[model samples]
Target: MQLKNILFTSLLVSALTYSAKAQFVGDALTFSQENNGGTARFKGLGNAKTALGGDISSITGNPAGLGFFRQSDISVTANYLNANNKGTYFGTNTTKNKGRVGIENAGVVFYFPTNEGYHGWQNFNVGISYENTNTFTNNVRYEGVNPNNTIVQRYSDLMENPQNGAWGDKLFKTVLVEESLDPKNGYFPVVGEAVNKNQVSDILTTGYNSRTALAFGANYNNKLYIGGNIGFTAFRYDTSQQFSEGGWTKNRAEILAKNPNSTIADPTHDDYKYVEANYELLDDYSQRTEGSGIDFKIGAIYKPTTDWNIGATITSPTWLTVDDYTSSYIRVDYYDKETDAKPFITKEVLTDPTEDSYRLITPWKFSVGLSKFFSRGLLSADVEYVDYSTNKLRTIGGSNRSREKAWDQDMKDSYKAVVNVRVGGEILLTNTVSARAGFNYFGNPYKNADNKQYSGSLGLGFKLSQNVYMDLAVVHLVNDYKVSPYAIDENHWKSQSPVADIKHQRTNAVLTLGAKF
Candidate 1:
């Protein structure tokens, strides 16, 4: 029993639902799911600023933190980021790494102290800030040998299936086929048997998710602070993939060169010693997305005393409008000893410059935090939850409404809610210097545990002057996941062929400068 034949007998449930809908894969990964980008201080402390309010970043996490301010302040942050991906495929392993720099955060806050006549109000503040929330810059490459079967078997299966029209189907119409072997059924991949084939795939991605926010807040006496913010968000994600497979070719120039006179009909190569191998469908595919949206944030901070604090925040789903473009091409190679055909070459554009527009409703989020204040610093922790399944996809101008509806249902069926936790603390080592550390845990969005992310951070702050400060921070993250290059309903190794186990490591260094007036 051939491997491809066995695949047909056992189609896993996950494979069955892989792409019966509209999108192919990794569609939802484009969203900013863990938007924690902020000032060096915030990131250094695991971004757990909910109840330990007072910094510029706190304005977005919990606007009420803005009300805790008593001075006009401005700050800017820059970050250097590096990512590495290690992949293990059928007995082979590979690794790739990339690095870049960007402005992580910049913002200004204005404060207004209430007059003495205002007994309950302590201060009012307004803020404007920008943050790079998510990054998608990574390079991953994986390769391995597959003696079981080849991609050509997929094309053969497509033709053998009754659903894909008759012998004169679209795929059958291609010139790369041997119809004589099965005139009634379909065509064969090669004139002879195939063996010793291997597959290599590469995936490259780059882009970002950013947000600009305008916020307002006020302090009530010495106990409560409340605020709201309006945020504008934008995202861009670009990715490309290249996959190649090679193996059996009697006329494979290598073999043909040795046996210059051997015909395609020659099976055992009585005249030739070794024939060069051949591969089909060396292909490249690319996709890009540009989008923008608006979202709202409201939050409150309660301080019963100077020693204890509690905070809560709510964020509405972002309504994003996006434009997607994709292109792809494939090259197939073959050689025929008969009909005087030599190294047949043909290229086809599988996808043109296709454009698509759609709306995405991101999930709503809720967060809560607690803090304990000391004479020198504070310790804080936060917990957040968002139902990723609520992420929805709608049709454009009612185009393909029914089909999109089904896709949305699939999104809900495949996704679930996630819980993220963060903890951090700052300690004033001296009157002019401070130290900070934090840890964050992000639950996996997938049903399996292989995709979760964990981050740890360390930082330092220097009080340059009474009104000037500088902060430095470093964060490290690790992710373990699986990437599938392609998943047809039935690639005998459909369960394994395109799937690669990937281990990813990311590091970031941020420096922030701030001024208080």
Candidate 2:
């Protein structure tokens, strides 16, 4: 084989190994962040904006909203959130109680007039801004006996009783030797044994994402609006596992039959027992899954009268190409299963790890919002829909798991169009201060899955100057879901692991500081 071919093969193998260890689904790359008062207004109406203005964060929801801006604007925001996650496997508890924290968005925009002085067109506006769509961190614990009890016990029993025709007994014969025997045995004899018991494990994951977008738009005779944005996204993720994995026979039984410091009279002191070994595998997978993509948005606001306005927008999906890297390490040790006693031992460590890369296609989204003006205030609403079923994971190299995940029934299931409804209005309490409130409802994305969510919000905005204003919003989110595994144990012929149900509640808060010129 050529040297280059061998190197390429090794690299592919490493990539596949890394991909196998990072297997997981639904790390949703979509935004879960809501503008402080977005949910409240969203609930009252929905994102049906005939006139888009005020909040810059709303640009992603309705770029036409930018057409409402009379001048250039910039805004920075921060948010905090708490989540509860749970999982159940075949009526058995698998994982539960997960939480996380993260940052949402910060960016600026410059709105340009036609540059030719808005002659033929009513108004020409172009701008730039940044936003965050997804933030996550979760930890789960699964215990209550390793599900493969039958197979494991068989391996253990064979080791304990060498005469038993089991795989462990066969393995014991292959490695045992005469030179390893103790003086008491007439002939040098090496012994081996196996044991089986419960195996408990813990899994953890941490992730975050933020994006920078350059946006531009225009308004024609205050009646029609159109715009587009090119966004660059940054993504980070890490996953790890801790498990008890060393009880297979051959090795454990030998430790029991050996009375290294004792004579035949003290044989009773040396006994055979199952060895419980625990090891922690740490995988630090950190990389930038970045790609630049363009999204086009066109909207129109038709005003039949001065007080009422109707609007709508169609947003193209942002197609992105992602690249990622990962690394891992493992350590192991043994203890007496029954007595909880640690035998004199040293830890085994594996530091070098394999690395790999892969790609993912997140789905496209669609939304629309509308608003109406009254004597003292104005009311607005918006609606959004997304097709998550089209999302997919692509394997770039040597892994079979990716192939398996591709053909897996769970991955094949189609997700429903998730819906978001929102309603909001502003009341002028005074010349410079305005009050706002809104509500929003988001339908679950899973097709036959459970986990529905809703939110409510309120806020206050004060204009410091003609081109500057500060707004503070308080939002509350009520989220609930059902988490169940597709299958419980592989050996169950007729008993497939039924999806068990689990529910969770989450809450978050957001604040935005902005300026318009």
Candidate 3:
């Protein structure tokens, strides 16, 4: 295939294509994004631990905060998530829900205090942590009548493009589409015109990204805290889509009437004999991806006054090696009425599972934060920046340099840098009770699209005993975006194609149990 055609197909058909090595701009973005998932206290605080210290979440948020530990500590967190997606396609709306429960995080910090008056260093701390940074569990379903085009038209268009080669041969083999009698006309759907086909699709995705880090921190003269961590990340993503279209109305007579100058094939041929009134097509595609990466982060927090803390951190790009596996199949069912006894015929085609591997470098991230301490409460805020355009992909064993370069260029052309903001506060409601609230805003990274995400959270902390405590947090997130099932060149279909607008919402409940020694 031509490089341009390959790029176009990879981007437009990311969800539908059966290509095993289809790493595109979307995959780059998915791996770069992070979620505020950690201990309930930190999650409730909008993950604003950059400036505030004394929490295990700091191992991932800002290792420098580990210096605030006055004693050895250990904590474990559990989470429950519920995702809801509302999709609108071709004037029809559908809602789907998915739920999952898992362990969110666990960590331990060991504090070593220096001898009093031993230089300016007050203490050194070491920490080990495991955190689930992102979850991909979701489900979406939408159906509607399409009046303009069908996926068959897209296949027909592809058949005309020489660069696409014989990829559409399977469509012809399955009898879903047929080659035109005239070579110049290319291919056409056997079921006829592209209009008024009832289309429905159900998609399900499941996976997660997690990080394990070994961190170290130090406190200097009770004012300056510095820390760094070496982090390893694990990633897995799986998605499956089942699409079906029906309501076909076509007959040999209708074809002859529409094209007066056309030549009709044999009357008994499958293409000419069947009325196609009850034709239906089913397309199923699924993909699984697994990968691992490594990154480094260093940060510092300075306290110039007893009430004010300033913090900053810089994280190096993550170097990821990914492997993808994909498989797909198509099925067509129709009935022939010309026989003495009408019979239903089914034709199916399947592709062998394929696998590919590659490497990706995510963009660097920088963040700064400020926190203010109060007699009964504290408030903190943070700002982060990342340039999505900097993401790059490399083919394994240096095998497809041109393709890799094209993907890299596409990332730069389709993405941009954006700033994220987070704010949160904790109030001591009673001697043994605390209340926390937070808000987070993730900026849009697309160059020509709006896909920002927002999250809000509320939490409570209980001092069950002097040595043990419990924290509970609830978070709500919302994101809205659009997806195209298929794409056609403007020359083939001048009008806009059908698209699905999806509004996704997620609710998370987290509980953390901790003890200090």
Candidate 4:
């Protein structure tokens, strides 16, 4: 039965090697999503700026809101972020934290009142702004014991497959897996069964997605506002992962006891001399991705009454040209009890990094909002829709038809459309002071996973003096997901694979300083 399964997996691995360069669906989703980030006021209001205008953030949200500017305005925003992750693997929990401080946003808008009367065109506004739209800074750690299987089984399977070529030769040289005496039986793992082996993994990631936009807006009779913007986005992402497994011994007596009828029980058997103890393996992988893209947005705001505003906006897909580089290293250690007391060690390193360049098209976004004005403050809400399945990847400057089709199929199978919601309200406590609170819900985009995120915020605004003002906001967000360290064919293994549950939390504090002239 074992031999039959080995042959089956060999064929499968052989077929997969042809499309090794295909991009993961998760990568597509990562590039398609953005955070609600801008000025402190915008963050304080849950980023529901589709309808409520007059802020520099409008250059990215609803350009039409730029028309609300009655004077030249300029502002700068800074932010501090703290992120924590708790990962649970096989019932064992581990935690890690990270922090960073940086400039979040900066922009300026100039307002020009048209010479035409109020009955016709009221005003025109132009603005330029830069914003950090998404942050990928995080750290995660998970450790546990697997009693069912070891990663060696995966390497052993690949070693037996001729289609994978020499990819697993290092495992053989390191004696992590040995070829069967009977060639028909294929390769066998030297580490034996899972049996109380400890496993640990640490992952770190850092990056940011930023955008700069030039926008224009117009006001009609002081009742309607419309605007548009062309934006350029820059992206960078880097991640490193280290995984280690150890704390087990290979005993010939124990192996024979577990399978008394096996060939190893016979002293004359060629495999009987395979006695080892205290086995360990360390694997490291790192990858870096850099890219840039361009997109366009248009929006409008309508006032049905003095206290009501209705707004909507549509964003085009961002077309990105991405480049990726990756490298890997592995080390193995073990004591050859029968040969010497000292441990035997072997290492494998890929000195040259593999590079791939491609094109990615993100999903389009549609949003609608409503704002109700009170005597002193206002309440606003926005709903946004995005179809993640619309994301696509293609080969750059060449054609890889099969790979492109496979990537397209994977996107459709892995993602779905989702709706995001934001609600916020602000009230004036005094003529010069105001308070704000908001909530945001981002829906899950995966077709087979629960990855919803929730956020809440609080803010304070101070009118220091006429043209000079300051705003402060704090937002807390939570997200949870599951990750698998490696994949194994369930049918080929007796034990089920392990999965890690990760809970991520982040807090952001932002301060905006600005003046209106």
Top TM-score hit: 3
The clash number for model 1 is 4
Q: What pairs collide in candidate 4?
A: none
As a whole number from 0 to 100, the lDDT of residue 217 in candidate 4 is 94
lDDT of 4 by residue, 1-517 (tens): 1221110101112123532433345577887899877999989998989999989899999999999999989999999999999989878999999999998999999999999975888899999999999999989888998787787777666666676555666456665665665555466566766688788878888999999999999999878999999999999988787888875545666544444444544578754544555667887777788999999999999999989999999999999999877776667766555355656654463334568888999999999999999999999999999999989998886588888888888888778899999999999999999999999999888776657589999999999999999999999999887766654555666655567778899999999999999
lDDT of 3: 0.81
Report each candidate's C-alpha RMSD, comma-separated, in the order given. 6.3, 10.7, 3.9, 4.8
Deviation in Å, model 2, residue 105 alpha carbon: 3.2
TM-score of 3: 0.92
Cα displacement (Å) at residue 260, model 1: 27
Q: Which ranges in model 4 have alpha carbons more than 4 Å from their true place?
A: 1-23, 157-162, 179-187, 253-274, 336-342, 349-352
Angstrom error of the Cα, residue 180, model 2: value is 28
**CA displacement after TM-score superposition, residue 271 of candidate 1 (Å):** 20
What are the runs in model 3 whose C-alpha is more than 4 Å off?
1-22, 180-185, 192-194, 253-265, 336-343
Candidate 1 is scored at a TM of 0.84
How far does residue 347 in candidate 3 sit from its true spot (Å)?
1.9
- Count of steric clashes across candidates, in order: 4, 38, 0, 0
lDDT digits (tens) for residues 89-118 of candidate 1: 777999999999999999999999988555
- Candidate 1 RMSD to the real structure: 6.3
Worst 10 residues of 3 by lDDT: 1-10
Model 1 lDDT at residue 395? 64
lDDT of the candidates, in the order given? 0.73, 0.47, 0.81, 0.81
